[model samples]
Target chain A: MASETKLSHTTALILHALDAGLVYGFSVMEMTGLPSGTVYPALRRLERDELICSQWERQSIADAEQRPARKYYKLTVAGRATLEASRRRYPLLERLIPTVEAKQV
Target chain B: MTARVDMVVRAFQRGFLSCISLLVPSGQRAEWRREWQAELWHVRRACAPAGAVSWQAEREVTAFCLGAFQDALCLRLHAPKNEPRIALLHGSALQCLLFLGGVLAASYGLTLLLPGVRVESHPERYQVRSGLIMIQDEAYSNDWVAATIPVERFRDWETTRQRYFDGLAFYRIGEQAVSAGSHGTGGWEVAEASKNLFSLLGLPVRFASQEGEADAGLPQAILSDAVWKREFGGDPRVVGSVLRVGGRDVRIAGVAAEGGWRLPGKADVWLLERDSEIAAGGRGHVVAHLTNQGRSEMWASYVHIDAYSPDEPGDNLCGFSFEERTRGPWGIYQFTVLLAFLALPAITTVSMGEYSVSSHRPSWSRRLCRWGYMGAKIALLLPIVYFLSLDVAYWHTTLYSLASEYAQLAASFSICLFGLRWALLDQRQRCPVCLRHVTNPARVGLASRTFLAWNGTELMCTAGHTLLHVPGLPTSWFSTQRWLYLDTSWEFLFTGSGVG
Candidate 1:
């Protein structure tokens, strides 16, 4: 049940972040107000499942300011298609509620 | 909030310890740490339940997240029961070998497509003393007949002069041809005659013969294609025109194609008759003649000396020999063969070396072994290929020779591919040498204690004899440095003690 919930939210956030140019964890957090706790683990699960792909940025000015480095993520070709299909299947309200609730506390 | 912090700390610790157990080698330690931290952070957020905003609820959620994180971490840290070994098909060395093999095959294919002709002539004489003189003898009975043939008629002649010149035909001789010596007279006469005959036949003969005494005594000259183009500007009307040569007016009797004469190096001017005496008597002359079938032959003949010395009380004095001289075409073939052989090995060696170096990292012993193997393979194949190529080339079936050349190149390429793969992957290890994490170590010195287990086994086996001393000494001495040294000395001191 936890994994199923995680799979759905992670997929939704990845799609939303990708569309918003929130291609990395910090950017996703800034865009969606999701804590590092929610965003990164979802990103990893999405990557492991082949729904999204991530690559470590060789040099990051923001990372240098914060820590050593950060990995950038993007929707794979399959992920983009899946997101489009899922958007057609679910009502806009249903998708927004879970994301909003996940973001809120 | 405190409970959540405590849970987060526990999750982080578990993940960190799992990573440590996996023994993230020094080179990748930093990356593993970052990945673990990120994972811990994500686990906390994702596993947090829908809440009524209580500290106890938050604590319960965090602890649950920690437990989940530990389970995942433990799974990752444990080695798989069926860990995948590197496959021959997927290895990087294999990929490189495939790429190199394709390139070499393409190159060998391209070499076959180049257009060029390889000519063969038997006893193929390259340098000739007298090409035109030989032609005259081959054409007529003697120098007298060649001389009297009227230089205008001789221009129609076509001869193949491989070692000498090609397509030479005499046209005319000047009045002073009688004064030039045997060497000069016959060649000059032939040159003039060939020029005149080609002109009369309306064929292209580039050079004209000089008429006046000023030019006549010097030499009879035939014009080259370049000179013809320069002097006549490629004018067809200039065939019968007179030109100045050696300070005398000479008549152009014919035009010649520059390709006709196979002069040793460069030949622009051919003298008709340099000595008048030889021209008159036709003694001691050589000439080249080509049959209609394109085969060339040389003839050395003499003219009746009595014809020139008619006033003297003459006996039959044809003061020259009629001998057929033949030399085989072995020299040129040998030279080309030597060049091909010498160049092949050097090129192959370089290609093999390049393949070896690029495919694998440098290791002295491995490289040496691969080099030796490739060298032996090539050495065994070269002589057979060379002789086979020669036999094919001899029959003028050089297409087969070309094919064999390509095959040799292909074999060389294949050898290079295999050699490179063998060289590169020969000693690669599955784990990092110094830290014991999954890695490929090129050097043994860089291996860590865990990776050093194999080498340690070898050392122990080599010193197994030292474990027993006089059959009764304490085995503890094997592990101690001082006792071990004493034991080693005792074995050496008593060679007949049956340690073997």
Candidate 2:
């Protein structure tokens, strides 16, 4: 149901950030330099579009550190396709976000 | 330390989370709150290297606050065709007051009618507690162990009580003319008791004190029937006659009922505790009732000069134990009833939560959730405790002045009771979507914004649906200014391009 071609620059940036290994919300915020307001909603929209999927990090990791569990995001096949297409659409994103081949999973 | 910064951020997050609770469906409330909190935690930690009291929380939380508003609005716009938007009944103010008020009114009515934890025979006994120290139940198990009432805590309460209670009789005792009346005169020993001490002791009033008379510049005293018989020859007119107490000639306002009287010291006369008695640290016995959790406070109000733990455990009963008839068999029954009220839905201490917090810190918003729960409980109790202290302060100040005081207490306590009960009982302790009773419940409140029970937690139903929502404090007040500034700018930038 998602209109992928209409993806906004913010959405593309978030997808690229996810592919580039800036997986969690704040990490994506750091990689993209977008505010929490922008980053969270964009993530929600991308997930809704089936371009990305998220799972909570292991509880042990959060326990090892003294903090809350982080939600980790990874590109779906569709998400990878979108990121590849976005790289062409937003040329600057290629430099900002990592390519999928650079990531192991 | 990070504590100071944590305080401010926690307060903002608490209020913001309370508002967010209103937007999500009830079934999903618990889950969403946790997820959002976790997200916020990560957001803050990511910037923790910035400083302990980083500006990041302000910037980050503000964005999150705005995001909640956007989510509420956008989620509504993007709601699936079959799913209805999350909607709380948009009742008129009167309607809100009517339903919520009715629930509150009933909760208090029940509390007032129900006798709190009590020993049927010894009504004046209290379970002593203090802010600085908590006397665990083990200490209460033995015979009465004495703890010197914390004068400092009482003094702090004395100084700060005016902030919550409006009554002058109790707090403004310093302003009263310390009665120049005789302190010790006739062989008449005097006892100081609360207004309901007689009724609490299962005795009836032989002569009733007039409402407001305690504040009317008239001295008030209650004579035991024996004392009345011996001193005034049982003359009915003695009720209005003045009896010398301390330096003041306190009027004989009433005579205690005669039959089955069993008070320690068997004082000939009873009167309201005076301001000076508080200063003097009156020695008294500890009264532990199975129901009242806040007993030490009663001791702190009076009993000024004694040391805490007046006797060794060998000589005293200190801890709380119902398994052995420490007080009496009836005390056990009373405790069971109290426990039932606290644990069962529609009883006392009702918590409405769907999911318990799964893990401790490093869980995003870990400290915030724990602190928020504590803050909520304090926020709920502060006003009740405030007015309660006022009643303690205003004891016998005026005839009939107690009705309003008690009504204030009942109202506040009822609100707490109503919140937990409504979430549990009226809602059937089930997830609205799944209609399963298998749910957890918790109560939450705004930080520093005590007296309002706006935030109720949500849990997922066994059906795994997160589609129900509960009514909450309308956040219009919280949103107004922010809406004008952040929202206006927010909408100005992104209104036409609303997201799915």
Model-by-model DockQ, in order? 0.04, 0.27
How do the residues B393-444 of candidate 1 rate in per-residue lDDT, one tens digit apiece? 3333322232433443444444444443343333121111111111221222
TM-score of model 1's chain A: 0.63
Determine which window of 10 residues in candidate 2 chain B has minimal summed lDDT: B479-488
Candidate 1, Cα interface RMSD: 6.7
Q: What is the lDDT of residue B426 in candidate 2?
A: 34
Q: Write the per-residue lDDT of candidate 2 for residues B114-174, one digit (tens) a residue.
A: 3321122233232212121212223333322333223333333234433222211111111
Candidate 1 stretches with Cα past 4 Å from truth are A1-105, B1-222, B229-240, B246-255, B263-285, B288-335, B338-500
Residue B441 miss distance in model 2 (angstroms): 40
Model 2 error, position A44 (Å) = 1.4
